[model samples]
Target: MTTDAVFDSPAVPGVPLPAFVQTLLWAGWPMEFLERAQERYGDVFHIHTLLFGKEVVLAHPEDVKEVFTGDPDQLRAGEANQPLEPLVGPRSVLLLDGPEHLRQRRLLLPPFHGERMLKYAAVMRETTAEDLARWPRGAVFSLHPHMQRVTLDIILRTIFGAEDPRDLTDLRAALSKVLDRLGSAFSTIATIPPLRFHLGGFSPWAIFQREMAAADKLVYARIAKRRAEGPREDVLSLLLSATDEEGKPLTDPELRDELMTLLVAGHETTATMLCWAFDLILSHPAVRDRLVEEVTGAEDPQRLPYLDAVLKEVLRMRPVIPAVGRRLSAPLTLRGRHYPTGTLLVPSSYLVHHNPEVYPDPKVFRPERFLDRKSDPYTFFPFGGGVRRCLGMAFAQFEMKVVLAEVFGRVKLKKARPGPAKVTVRVFTFAPEKGVEVVLEG
Candidate 1:
């Protein structure tokens, strides 16, 4: 899918900074950098950077629609996600394109089907309740780590079918180490060419390698045990029985990669987004009160429109991942303009969600907007869009509702620092800066 053919540079305005400088800004403070670029260059802009190359960022909903619905063959999302390959491995659905990607996606889709969430709901609710009961009452604490613990436990039990306490503890510790390191601020250095080297065990790169190896050992062990024991309800069991068109089951390496993909992608993103939910919900008393009222005595919080709307608004206001990208392998027309092969075309979810035209008073925390109208796919895609959209989207949202219900129904939380939310840049995600500090009000 590569060629030596040359094409002219994109016709859009570009970020007026050195490539390295732009790389640093984009890597370190992506939302801030993107907002500044949008303000300066309008909705359509380009930035040439060392890390991601020439990226054409599209923020207008129409433009976003074009990229989202564009041909996946020509718009190779897998290529655009190379930085993630080291973490999720090459066989990961996140790093596959065209036919390979489709096969893997189909195999992975069954476990995350909307109806399947009902089976997993019990695990989610139980995990959330148990985690919340341990939170320090009437004292300020970082809710992010606690949320992480809850979500990780849910992922372990519901997704991995991890029932053994010994295995759970080992897997949890290993996986947490890997994610904590990968999601840390300094993790960005490992992505840069000049800065990405190992200086023995203490080096960031070396330490990540060690943690990943530890996690992989536990994951592979689980896969083997599941293979021997036969099918159960969890995602791993379903995947173990899954096969490609040729009727071949996924190999050990493939299973390892996909499991790692689910853990790394699902764990932190869901936890961090949950943190944003509390940050937003507590900041807006009316919204919080209405949400609590809706979830308090409800038989199923998932069916509560207001609770669903609250999560929807939280995703809209603070998307965990700022953008989804596709590297063009053939010339493609977007927003009435054509981008050549090798151009990384990105649909900025943060920018589109914040667009005043699409969302009036976009900065306001208003779940009622969703209650009034259905969200347009292109305008509100926190889980991304098109065929390559996140497969775990439904599961994550369902899990969020269960956890939120447990929180709002059982306890009242007030933000320790009541103000606008501050975003911290992990390597690839947007998280609460101070972990969304909060206190339980009796």
Candidate 2:
């Protein structure tokens, strides 16, 4: 639909703002915009923006459940996530639908299985400890960048299986460069058709292409090297050995794209959540003391209920990815209203997480609530829901627990800057404006 046509649509109700204006607001101030829109429009609303076009936002848990549990053939996440093709590649499981999606998902699932997490946990703890040792003492610094480094390092070792010092350093730098390029302002503008054209080497699209190419080159080289070697424990090794129903292993490009998907999907989201965890935890003395006590005293820190509750509360309050989208291919009715085929349905994780009906005193950070009760799948979906849910959910949460145990157990930290960290939109996810500044006191 054209930009002008979005304004005339009576099927969806939303803020009476122009597409350009809405896009600007969404790009600049997503949290405030979403909060205000939900307050005015209630649980359901629409956002007609230049970037996303018209997507109906569902804030109610029941509505979210219906869409999540709806027919995968009818509500397609792959089609809805088309814009990510440039970043993750066309062959990624994230971009595949129906049988193809299931096949790819099955091949990828084994690497992140519960047993495999035990192997990855060692990498996670070691990576966090190594990075924590490097953090400056008696000086204020942003923990966000540090968290990014640790998560990216963990992804490299655990996912890419990079063990050589030279290869690890090289791959880390290349991937970091690609992510930096992706987070640029011009990158968002490059999504628009008219502005997406590459003029020359220095052009925004050209620069992005170059960064991706560099990262892919390093990753492809690692894949080739790993292919020559025998089976190993890392995710890439399993993926290398994995064959579909036809007994055909993944091609080089397919491997590259899936690796890229894991990197893009796992890196920033987990890092941002870590930053928010520290931001939230440090601000609450009682929570911090309790968490530290549990982590420091526990025989196995990962099994502690309070630590898990703290992570859950952090995710509930600050979901890194606010919404998950599904595009309808068949007419469906939601909350008594009929939505036609081609409608975009977004389950707003941020809104549902903060809904007073679902979470009493939603604005407050209380880990005890989670300790007493388990959250409904539709209601607490930081990693999203249904078959399309993130493959790294288990890995990410496990890493969080391991890292939190390591951090709180070894060091004492205090927020360097007063007041809560302001939420800011960074590329596709929400992040702390100041990168969660803090200092080590001990």
Candidate 3:
């Protein structure tokens, strides 16, 4: 759609039409929602619609940061995220806004930081090592599902304790099933009304809610049993004892909501990131060789700087969450461009990461760019910026590095296909479209 043909109006200056927005919403549109705009117009052009109704797209880093920071409250990931709300409940920390968002960030950051996170390092390394051992040499395995399962287990173990690993398995399967449904669910259920009830059977939300309720039973049972005995050192134990401004314990529902939120939001995003990393590495022989050389250089494997760059590169090239959204609280001008309240300003990771000026050779897999390039803080925001930024950032990075180290250190992945293969993205998420088959040789 041309700039003039889009939903631009007198009331909202420089905006596009709703008719153009509806055109993009048709099923199975090639490329992601943002990429389609990038291809049609330059990186800075707009898309008036997506799965979540109407919005504008900004691929530039400065514009992107403006959405995240200057207008954090304006561009939010909200209840409109239908498929996610069920597992996390109505009041997950992920969906909170403004003062509530601040409070949750404070409460959530401590367990995921400094000394507390260090305790999980050994667990991460051990888990990665153990999981990679199961990958048969030359096997055509899908890393996306494997990474999800592993991260699910890691989150469960870190959040709960190792005492009941089976509980983690059940929760993983339950949450995965719900996510799979959402990823596949189309119709009025996905857009328009956001249905919570089904005519013949339980709705998607209902199935997920039942799973969440079952998972909560396990959480509360563990908490009750733990309290009956003594204090423990896990997040569940900490949250059980934590008070919210008022010196009262976190309720069962709140605890369960947070637990479920972390598992679903944290695991899925990171696992998608890792799968992208594998695809990026396997495709480029030189990058793969350097990563392997860096990772395998020590009696004890090292944190290879370039390998870290490779992961950063993958995240940049194929960011799982393509858009970081915020809604306007009070109307304002961003870079002298005015927008109305409730206007959805999307700072697209797809655009920002591929911004040629900020990231030279932005399309290529150059982990070196992150280390070598000069850029602003917002220029590399795989995790969203400002106060509402992801609390699990450190944990996700740690897990990604550990997993990458495990895979690259042990075996070399020879690409199974003859030509270059790219991951196919759906909505905001990206995954290896072919499951990334490769020959894993020792």
lDDT of 3 by residue, 1-442 (tens): 2223233643223324464554444234424555655766655554544465566667666676666666445555553354356557766887777667666666666788855777777777777777777777766666766787778778877876644657656656665665564455442243234566654546654555565566667666766766776666677777767666756566777777787787767877887788777877888888888878878744333246676677777877877886666666666576666766666666777677777877778777777776765546577777877766677887888778877877787777777775445556554566667666666765
lDDT of each: 0.85, 0.88, 0.66
Question: lDDT per residue, candidate 1, 79-127, as tens digits?
Answer: 9988887689989999999999999999999999999999998888888
Clashes of 2: 0
After the best TM-score superposition of candidate 2, give how far the Cα of residue 442 lies from its true spot, in angstroms: 2.3
lDDT of 2 by residue, 65-117 (tens): 99888889899999988888888899999999999899899899999877679
- Off-target runs (Cα >4 Å) in candidate 3 are 1-6, 10-33, 39-45, 48-50, 71-83, 186-194, 200-208, 244-249, 297-302, 418-420
Lowest summed lDDT over 10 consecutive residues: which window, candidate 1? 1-10
Off by over 4 Å in 1: 1-10, 27-29, 49-51, 191-202
TM-score of each: 0.94, 0.96, 0.87
